[model samples]
Every structure is written in C-alpha cells, then in structure tokens.
Target: MDRSKRRFVQALGATAAMASLSVSALAARRTTWDLLIVGAGTAGLPAAIFAAGRGRHVLLVDAAPQIGGTMHLSSGQMSAAGTRLQRSQGIIDTPQEHFDDLMRISRGTIDQTIARLAVGEAAETFDWLMSVGFEPLAGHPVSGLAHEPYSKPRYYWGARGARSILEALGPLVDRGVAAGRIDLLLEHRVVELTTSRRGAVTGVAAQDAGGARRELRARNVLLTAGGYASNAAMFEKLSGIPKFVDHSYAYSQGQGLELGESVGGYVRGAEKYLANFGVILASEAQPAPLLARADFYPERRPPWEIYVNAHGRRFIREDMQSVDAREQSLRLQPLMRHWVVFDQSVAERAPPLIVDWEKEDMLAAFDSGAAYFYKADSIDALAGAAGLPPRELAATIEAYNYGVQTGNDFLGRRHLPVPLAKPPFYAIRHQGVSITSTAGLAVDGELRVIRRDGAPVDNLYAAGEILGSGATQGQAFCGGMMVTPAITFGRLLGQRL
Candidate 1:
C-alpha cells in the first residue's frame, strides 16, 4: 500500500478503538485530549500548562513518574538580553547582541533561523520568569559562566538548580490539573503514532506501567519528549557516533523521536557532535561516568595536575578560554577518554584534585583507589599500574618537568610549574563525558518537526533535546540553550498553537 493507504488503515483502526470503548473505558481504557503532549519535562510541562491555561484540553504522558526529566539535573543557566532584570541591574544588552554572540560562539554552525527566533523572544521569556517569582543569583546577567563569555552580560541562573525552573512551573501544572484543563498520565510511554490518510499525526499509542496499551486522540500531537542520550543504541544509530558514556536522564530514551519518525518526521543534525573538555572520574570503562571535574580556572583555583591521552601527550593548553575548543578536541579522541597524571609532590603541595573533596575524603579515595588512585615510588612504576607505556610516559613527564623548571612549556600550561621529580607519583584516569548530545532532529522556526527532505511534517511538532543541541547551540554549549529553549518553545506553542 502507499503511504496514504497505510495511514488510512491506522486511522481507521484508531477510530474504531475509540468508538468501541464505553464512556468510563473511553476515559480510562483510552483518552481523547485536545492536545497530546509526550514527555512532561521542561518543555512538555510548560506546554501543558500554557495550553491548558488557554482552556485547551491537554493530556501529558511521561515514561517516568516524575515530570522534571533532565531538568532535575540541569544547571538552569540561561542567556537573554533586554530583560527586566537587565534593566534593574543596569546591564545593557540587546536581542541582536544575543543572536550575534550565539552565532559567534557556535561559529555559524547553528541553524541561524532557530537561533534568531530563540534570542529574539528569550528576553521576554526571562521577564516572564521574573514575573512568576523566579529569582536569579546575585550578580547574574553576567557576560557568561562556564561557557565562553558573551559580548554582553546576559547570562544568569536560578540560585537553585534546574529545579528552580521546575518549581516555577509546578504550580502552573497543578493549577491546570485542578481546573480540569490538563490530564497527566504518568508512567505511560508512547510507542506508536496513529496518523491520518494525509500523513498528519492524529494520536499516539502509549503503554502504561501495567503493560496496558491505550490510544490517545488529539487534533494536535506535540512531541517534547527530549533526546536519546539515555538510549545508547539509538544514540549511536541516530548520530552515527559511538556513545562514549551513558550520562543522561535515564528516561530520555528518544521515544518521541522514534514515534514521530514512525509516522513521517525526519531526523537530522547528527553532524554537530562535540564532547565535554574532560571529566574527572573513577573508571576507564564504557560509560566513563563523571565523578569530579578538572576545572582549570587558575584565577579562582589552579589545576592540581595535567591531562594526557592514551599516547601520553598533553592535548590542551589547560588554560584556554574556549570550552568549545576543548570539547571539539576531546571528541576527536578514539573513545572520549583521557587520563590525569600528577606526582606526589604536586598532590601534597597543591589543593586536592577533587575540588569538593575534603582532605579526609581525598586521603580515603587515594587509600581506596576508587578513582584510579595509584601510588608508586617512581613515575615508571605508576605508569605500569596505570596501564600506560612507561618509556613514553617518562618522556612526557620529563618534557613537562623541563617546562616547569625552565619556564618554557610546550602545551602552555600556566599553573603547576613545579617539576614532578618527587617520589610516589599519582595518576587518576579521567574521561570525557556529557549530559547532552550534539545530534538531534531538525526543527524549523515554528518548531515544526521536519523530514530529511527539508519539508515539515504536517501537524507534527518537536522541541527540547529531541531536536538535538547541535541544531541550536551547534558544536558548542551555549549555557542555557537546552533547558531555556525547551521551556520557551513549549510555552510559545501552548500560547500560539
């Protein structure tokens, strides 16, 4: 059968299913909502709240019982220009500057249209948050934070983590529920989509926790279900890149993307993959999960040591201002993993390698070897235990020591000019890890889901991480692109659509 025929059959079956069920069964066996939103997260939640507040009946479904999704762990950093906060703080900025800085930071890799729209309305969204009682940290709206500095001071975060945004959204969600404008079906994962003969999405087939399948029909089907960061297999397949580590929201399984594609939506933007600079961790295994950070802001706190790959060579300036440069380099590595090597003298003389670790905790980790803590009488012995070539490792150390003593570094490592000529050398294996993906579905200015052919899928919409970080932020992380856009687009759709 043709594409239209297949959709006709599916639509007919869904219509019959809807009609055969009794009222309570129709209400419980299956549901009909004005708008069916998959993934009640930062994007999905705000969408539900805004749509339902507009008196449109909305049904919110999530695979996880909780609603926050990745926002629970997000930093909640955001960028916006010309906001009320900016006015109050006397921080001068403009949407044009925001757009220019975003493109500049991403090096024109981002979809300019999407970036333009996002930056244009971002200031309004920021003001909305302030009106809703969201407070920023002191001296917020700064030029930038961990990401590269923007041209203006327009970046800020809630004093709390991502939950701060959720907290601001929670009451609106509850109000929607109390007003009977929105129905939340938690623990239900969308598996299939039912479309009309014209290839327009009409409803979704979701499975509840009890292994029960139900149909939800709607005039509009929106997918804010997030990205495939948690699903390693799908992540690799979609992006054509190996998942170096598993470090995303466990429930972000690319469900919405899969369902949308099943109907007609096309996925794109896999070409923009980038990895985090480096991660201090406890293992060299496949999910080289993060344990701590090797933050190199010497002005605040100096780096206790340096990093080397499997070849035993430094790969970074170790003091570069460009997080993008650092991340792009790390992604080029074979498995997105690196090792941090230091000597006992540096370990004893400098601050602890793990920033948050108390002196007792550091000593315990060293004693326990939980984070590849190894002690040896010599550098070669430490290399042996750390599974690195002793000769090459020794040579690398020699060069580093020469740089430290002679003040002529090869890697331009500013701090830790001390030589590693002391006994009991230490090496902690660090890896590259991130909670976001550079690959995702391609979306247009209106946030409509599109096909690989550059055509919009009628009545199908996608937002949030499902659209991929690469499409919006490009190869670089722009602080709040992930959460802010998710929330912004979700709200925009709710009010407009």
Candidate 2:
C-alpha cells in the first residue's frame, strides 16, 4: 500500500480503538466486507442482490427500520426501448430512439454520457424485471402518460403506486440473505467515513439503532440513500431553494448527500430545480396540506371553465393538450400561484370544481369563504367581492360573453366556449407545488460520484433520486423520467458496477 493508504488504514484502526475504549474495556475487533452498500431502498437492494449473486460478501445497511426507501411512495413508472417483453408483444423500439427522445425533450441539459448509459442499457434491466415476474398496469408501456409523449410505446407502471416494484425485488433479496451471500443491518446509520491519508475510503463508522458504534472495512461502497427532499435545511442549502412541500418519502433525509460530501464527493445537479404546476389547496405559509387538491388537470376531467389569478384574468391557453405545456406555463409565474375563477352558469352545468365535493360541500365552502362565491346582480360587483379589479374582470366577462355570442374566441378555449352570464361568480385560490425536486448530485456515465475538483472518487457510486430529477429531466418533467431513470440507473449500477 502507498503511504496515503497506509495512513488511512492506521487512522481507521485508531478510531476503532477509540470507539472500543469509549464503550468498555473490550478489545477492538474488525469486520471486512467485499462490498458495503449503504441503504436498503430501491437502489441499494438491487445492488446487494446483484453483488451477492456474484459471490461477493456484501453488507447492506439502512437507516430505516425497514427497506423500500422512497419506492414506497413513488409512482414507479419505468421507461425503456426494445424490451424483451415488448418484442414478444409485437412492440418495436430501439435504444437509439430512446436516447434521441430524451435528448430532444431534455433539450441538452442532461449529461450525454449518463443518458446514453441509462438509455442504452435500459431495455435489458427492464427485461430483467420480467424474468422476476414483475407485472405492469393494464394498457401500460404505452406512448406516454401526462408529460411529453414518447416516440414509441416505452413507458410502463406497476399496479399499485410503487409497491409493485418493491414486491418483485423483495423475494430476490430474501433469497440472497438465505444463501448467506448477503447480511442486512437495518436501523444502522453511517455517521462518518474512515479514510486512508491518500483519501481512499477504508471503512465506515456507524451507530446502530441501540446507539452502539461499530466499524467495518470494505473494498467498495455504494451510496443509494435517495435524496434530501425530506430534509428542509439540507434541501435548501444544497439546491438554493426552499422545500415547497413535504410530499416525498419521510426517510429521504439526504443522509447520503451529507455522507458523500464528508468523504470528498461534491454536489451537482442543483441547477435543475423545476416545480410541477397546479398543486392545489396548499397554503402560502406552510408545507403539506391544509386542503385537498382540486384535481384541475383537464385531461383527467375536461376543464369546465377558465382559471385565473387573484385579479380574475385568464393566464393560459385553457385548452392546451400537454401537461408539460401547462406546468411550464405555471413555472413561469411567481410561486406557481393562481386561482380558478368561474361563474354560476359553470357551477350549475360544469363538472364539480372539486373532485368529490358535492353541492352541499361546495355551498359550505362558499358560505365559509374558504372558496370565493359572490351573488352579485352584475359582473362588476362579483369581481369586487372576489378581490379582483372590477373593470378588468368586467371587461374579461364581456369579452367572454361576446365570444359565446359570436362563436369565436381569441384564446380558443373549447370546453367553456360559452359566457359566464349568471347570478354569481366563484374563485378558488391555489399554489404551485411539487413532490419531487429537479436538482440532484452529479455523476459520470459510469455513475461514479465526483468531487468539486472534477476527479472521480474511486469505489464510490450513487444512483436514484440521490442524483436528482433535474439532472435527467431538466426544466420540465418529461413523462416517466424520474422514477424510470432512478430504477434504470439502480439496475445498471448493480449489474455492472
């Protein structure tokens, strides 16, 4: 070993000795592992399984009391080209085409190397899912869902949100452990790294659930510890943006980001923070919900009326077909905040404003002023009570009425190609909210974590949301991008790295 490696080994030894001394008068013992995988979530579990299959002694540790990580809450949509299942189903696709679609949608923001690695190897990993009896939602592996449409039918989702993906992998993990190829240490949190003087990782010092410190040496370490979305302070510090809401996995506290940085891995992908549009019913002051979502994505239910701001003016092409188009338009506004303004005519004839609310609940919202409802004889009085400038709202209503009479509109809104001429007008406040962050850690094509100085930290790797959605999806959420890339990259790391 070189001088640096020797120093790292010695330092680790001393730390272990100190830990033992602090605990009791017991002698220090050493445990060695061919591969030490941190986290037992979506990415880490597969790594453990694949490494164990290679006959390597593996130690899998997680901070959570259980496994499954963020996969427990994710939508778990997957994408690929030329999957074996697709071949058998008479579907045709190529990785090259998949690569082209990602680039075209991302508009060159994604790292080409990582994108290529993921797209090129995606189908095989997807095929592996089939070998394990992984099933998809009926009518899935279609062209796309809500985001940009795919060039070919390459997207698939599990039946239940993310559980379907986890169920398929759980049996494989159990098999690995039964064969003695893998040892799992749950409720164990890695605190610090034991490194050699040359900065090579020698081992990690961790505290178990019972608060006992232990040291273990390993030849390599893989960090699949999701992201910092659940950690507000770290999320703000790393991405320069405050946590908008707490809808992500609670265990995603960004422990891996801290651990990686402590060992000389610098952060990347912070530049890709993009929030999705139309997160309904969130208050301006806090995260989480004070009210449930209004479910305004017109594709789910055709928009019955126009949406507006607090000023009661139309702000978008209400008939636009693309969710991406709508979300991107919302992102351009401040805080993604807006309001849905309609009238009594819409209230009576249009679909319910809220998904499950009945006439009674809707009336209650109006009575309590939780939602805006004004019974004014004229449009100007309605606008004033709704807190909008009377003239602007009146002019807007008049223009809308003219369109209904003339059979033509400048905005081309087909759903309510009619006027809001009625007894009362209504409005509901909303804010732009997102469950996923676009910003994430930077990785090379091989998925190795790199330092700020642009040097690869050997034997260190990261996959899944730890790398951030923004790095791969860019400013807009391309459909199937976040969950798919996460799982695809996880599979790639396990089988190859």
Candidate 3:
C-alpha cells in the first residue's frame, strides 16, 4: 500500500479504538430518540450539544469512527458581527453589514434569506464558542485571507484551525453523553431514511462496518452529514464540474444529500458552483491529492509567470487583485484547468510561486517528472508536454514578451518583471478545484428540509455544508460563510427543535 493509504488506514484504526460501545449494544438501548443528528462533525456536534443541553434525548451517529467530521480538516475560519470579541477589540460591526458584504462579494447570488439568518445569529453562535473556551488566534478578526475581503475585520480563526472548534465542542458533547442526554454512535453509516406513510422522515436505518443493521426512530432527523466533495461521481453530477482534487473530509461522501433526496428533499445552488483559483495536484488523475498551491494573490507574490488555459490564451490578468474575479474567469475555461508558464530566468529570479516551497524544491519537481510539472527548452515542446496548443502557446508568449518590452499588456497586468526569453521554459499545471461541495440539499430559512414545491419535509432538517457551500456563499467564496453559517444554523436548530 502507498504511504497515503497506509496513513489513512492508521488514522481510521485509531478512530475505531476511540469508540468502545458496540453498534448492537447502542441500537438495542434506544429504539426512539427525541432528536437523531447525523454526522457528528461541525453541524451535528453543535446540534447534539445544544439539544442535549435543552434536556432533549439526542442520538448522534456518524459513519466515521470518530466525531468532529469536517472540523478536523476545515480551516475553522468564522465571521460574526457584534460579538464580544469584536466589542472587546472595539471594532464596531453589525449583522446587516455582514449580510450586505456577503451579498456584495457573492454578487447577490447567495440565498439572501439563509445568508441573512446566518449572519443575524452568528454573533451569538461565536460568543457561545468563546464562552466555551474557544480561543481565537492573537491579533485575529482580520478582514479576510484567501477569499474576498469583508469590509469589517470580523473574520477570526484559532491557531489550530477547525480543531480549535472541536476542542470547545468536544467537551460539551462528552458532558451530554456522560449525562445520558446524548447517545453517541460511531462507525455506523446511515443508509436509508425511514419515513412515515405521509412522507415525513421519522428515523434512519444505519449499517455498521460489521454489517449489523439497526433502525433508530426519532421525533426529528437532522442531516448535518456534510457535503459530497469527497464523492467524485456525486460531486460531478451535482456541481456540473469534475472533482479535480480530494482535499475534503474523507467521510464527506454525500450521505446527507442522498438521504434528503430519498425523502422528497431537493438540492439547489448547482448554478452557484465555483472552483478555487487552482492547485498543483499530486497526479493528473481526477480527484487527485493536492501537492501544493501557488500564491496567486498579487498582494502576496507578484506574478512573474503567465496563466494560460488549454487554448493557450491568457484568460485573466495575472496580477488581478480580486480572487473572485480570477476564479470566475477560470470557470469559463475548458476543464477548469490552467498552467503557470515561465522561463528559467523568471523561475530563478522571481520569488517562489508555490506557497511554502523554495526554488530548489520546485526545480526538483521538474527533474523528478512530477505529474503536473513540465520543462522544455522551447515553448512548443513545453506546450506539447503540458497538453496545451503548441502554436497558441508560442503566440501567447510572444505577445506577452512584446507587451513586457513595450510596457503595454493587453490583459492590464502591471507586474511584468521579465519576459519568457530565457531557455528551459517550465509549465506547472494547476487544476481549479474546491474542497467544499457547492450543491446541497435545499432547506428553508428555519432549517427545515424542503421539496422542490417549497414544502417542508416534516421532521427533516439540515445544517452545515449539507445545505451546500453555494447556499450561503453563492458563486463566490465569502469569507467564513460556510463554517460560520454551519455552526450558527446548527445551534439555532438545536435550540428550536
């Protein structure tokens, strides 16, 4: 087995050991639960915690061996307006402002009702985390990072990223389990949603790794089972784009989406599907592992290389400051793929293009025959190796070099450090990919799973990425929109349900 697969197996083994109760034992004890929360990660954990806190009997289950679903992998960045933290910092902000900023960044494509609800309740949700001992990084609450900047400095994350959130939530969940308010079941995948004859979701049928099947009834079923970014087939079917990389949580296999759809719940936001600028994959295979990401942000590293599509045309200004603009431009390209082309001189003199990698490490990639890294003495040879049009590649570089010499770039690029006149041209293929799922099960503002006719699926609710990243973020990635709304909506559901 390869090292990555081996490490994954080892991690699963450790997670399995963390749970002591057998599936049969747990299933035998609880025939009915007040609330059945699926996927004990970001949204489920909060739902379970808040529900149990309200003296409700909650049954929390996950296919993964342990809880803290995507939280283990998420950056854990959250944005909230009018929080104690913001107040302490004396930074005045409001939910309306947050809502407006998200709409502006998303170009008003976001579900305004959902976005408004999330931002409105975000402060309380963030405050609850802080009250529970969640610590933000020192000098945090920045305007933004990779995504478009928010007008206010409301963005915040812990030093440990999403794990920092799990730290705060884990203990509360433990307390609920200890108090017998929450029945925690792990290593069980919910295969089907058991619904009433009237089509109201009543419970779930789950199977353990040992193939032991159990049906657990519930007054309400909350599908916080996360997104389908990890499932290549489902991702492509829903997003209308290929899954280019596998950086999502391993357990995010779209169970929530499937389960919801089985009971009349429909999905939305497929049109809002958008990919990140790009990332260097470990291989050319679909859904490949991420190898490295370039610092495409001009503010971070001015571009010394030109970005070209499969047709070998410079699609966007390399020095464009707006991340959303760059991403939207990439969406129009065939296969959502692009290549970073540069000559040996630019490679040697320019600051490292790949984040965290030095020039030597990058140069080694070409020598090692890395899947996405190609080197050729001529532009035509480099184009052939990288699968770009040779004629167009040469012409594109010629135009770029002419512009560099004359100081008049057609794409309005300002940072023209050097032309591609040097020998041994290099091309690094970067595939546009998204870690979060954009298409998700449709839910009402109150967090109720709804059908295409806009009718609520009784006793069925959803929170977190299962609602789709596009629901809150729209076609653009709004800072902290996904993670923050997930926790906030989950908390609200727990309190209400």
What's the TM-score of each model vs. the native?
A: 0.90, 0.86, 0.95
Instruction: Compose the digit string of candidate 1's lDDT tens values, residues 1-497.
Output: 24432232121121222222222334863356778898888788878888997989888777775677787777889888889888987787898887788788898888888777778888888888878778889888887758777888888898787878877777677667556676666667888888889888888888866778988898888898888887888877765666656668889888777787787677777777776766666565655566777655555666657677787777876666666777777777756667778877787787766667765676677678785666788878888887778888899889888888877889887775578888878787666666676666666789888877778877778878888888779878887777778888888988877
Clashes of 3: 1
Clashes of each: 0, 3, 1
lDDT of each: 0.75, 0.70, 0.88
Residue 34 in candidate 2, Cα distance off native in Å: 1.8
Error of 2 at 55 (Å): 0.9
**TM-score winner:** 3
**Best candidate, lDDT:** 3
lDDT of 2 by residue, 297-346 (tens): 66777776666655566777676877667777776665566666677777
Which 10-residue window in model 3 sums to the lowest lDDT? 5-14
Each candidate: RMSD = 7.4, 7.6, 4.3
**Candidates sorted on TM-score, descending:** 3, 1, 2
Candidate 1: minimum summed lDDT over ten consecutive residues — where?
A: 9-18
Residue-level lDDT of model 3, residues 6-66, one tens digit each, is: 2322212225544435354565667789999998888888898899999999998889887
